[model samples]
Target: MKARKKISRRKHEVSTSNLIRHEVIGLRVTVVHSLNDKFIGISGTLIDESRNMFKLKCKDNVIRVIPKEVCIFKFELPDGDSVKVDGRMLNGRAEERIKMKRRKVVWPLIVEKQLKKARFQPEICEVLMFDP
Candidate 1:
């Protein structure tokens, strides 16, 4: 029988959970969309960022400021994972983004489970059993 080639995995796994929360100061990114005609298709290193805008050092050493609200960005992670993120989702500072609350919907099933656990007391169970 022929020997099979063993596939080796990397020793360290890259975590993508912190991608949105970590500082993106030096990451190379492309502007997938922009409201301003000048920055619509710019690709450059993120030299600086603020709560409202990002400054990209484009080719020819030209610095362009683009509003965070009017653009979509695409960047690659260290592990070669390409991510496309909306500008609105990245509106806040990197440090503040970690504290931002994500919008979640409370499912009926989860609410039902919580209600069942809350009503598991003996006294509540007796009342529930005798209730007309």
Candidate 2:
């Protein structure tokens, strides 16, 4: 009998790089900008999501549905890091988004970040060079 190697699973963490593939329900969200003036500056907990809209629990227990394409969302992570995302990039169902190929839109930014980190901290370069 052969001993099987156990696969280690990394817990999914949301970042600007993986915006479309992560679960976003229950995160604190804010509408930093919107095509409609009414939706600007609305902050709330995300209760639900659809292909084209988001349902949020706003102040005083009010629920509002805002179109995804018309607004820019700022999502606060559990670690207190905030990332702003454009709606156009996230235009698909959760399942579809996960299976879809990742766009290279953020690749340059990620390379820039790794380069900056490598410049400031030489030790990190060894780890980054081996990363896919």
Candidate 3:
């Protein structure tokens, strides 16, 4: 006579992403900051791109930064509509995890073409006026 035993195992499944696998290449991006009632902005043209990373070429500066560091990024599409993405820069293990998490949805080939002919220029720089 033999006894029956049950085995426990977890099923691993991959997920399909809805966010576009495309990267912002050669596009212009601006980072703005408003801290302690002071506003500051930096402008640069994009050079390198990963899923969540970008390197920019400024007029007098070169910055290799992460998307999370930006307060806002304005990208002009070939279609003529400016796509503005707003977010905050995050550091430490959280940032590393976010980058790692995006690996599955990121495709290098998808971003190469879009950034080939991109050239960004700064068109706006102004401090917000307070009307009190």
Candidate 4:
């Protein structure tokens, strides 16, 4: 009888880039801002087709743009009616929200509150790469 060889299991580590670029489908983006012209309280849905720039469907208009290059961005929501979002164009659907401010509160509770409120959509908005 031939002796059987012991099989070893090797663990492969997942890279950070792979983790960050995880795939997401059917995700939508919500943007609140003011346009240079007569557009105030400009709200729109962002479309991710590229990294440099994305398209926004305003109330009754469609505009393609590179958000990072824009100087000023403003929002008028209830909690913090005024927010300056550092906009960036990205590809695919985002699976997490990049919080601008890090709080000491529990993440789970905060996440629950976020889910309860529709102020921010879950699993949307991604980091746009400038040189990708």
State the weakest 10-residue window (summed lDDT) of model 1.
Answer: 123-132
Query: Which candidate order results from sorting by TM-score in descending order?
Result: 2, 1, 3, 4
Best by TM-score: 2
lDDT of 4 at 73: 35
Alpha-carbon TM-score of each model against the true structure = 0.61, 0.68, 0.38, 0.29
lDDT of 2 at 123: 31
Top-scoring candidate (lDDT): 2
Better of 1 and 4 by TM-score: 1
Candidates arranged by lDDT, highest first: 2, 1, 3, 4
Tens-digit lDDT string for candidate 4 (18-70): 22233211123344332222332444554443443445566576664534322
Query: Going through the candidates in order, what is the number of backbone clashes in each?
Result: 0, 0, 2, 0
Per-candidate RMSD vs. true structure?
Answer: 17.5, 10.3, 16.6, 14.6
How much does candidate 2 score in TM-score?
0.68
- Candidate 1: residue 45 lDDT (0-100): 89
Q: State the C-alpha lDDT per candidate.
A: 0.64, 0.70, 0.42, 0.35
Name the regions of candidate 1 deviating beyond 4 angstroms: 1-16, 103-132
Question: How much is the lDDT of residue 48 in candidate 1?
Answer: 91
Evaluated at residue 112, the lDDT of candidate 3 is 38
Cα lDDT tens digits, model 1, 1-132, are 999997654423322454565667787778875545576689888899888898999887999888876566876667777566656667778678656556222335654575466453333211101011
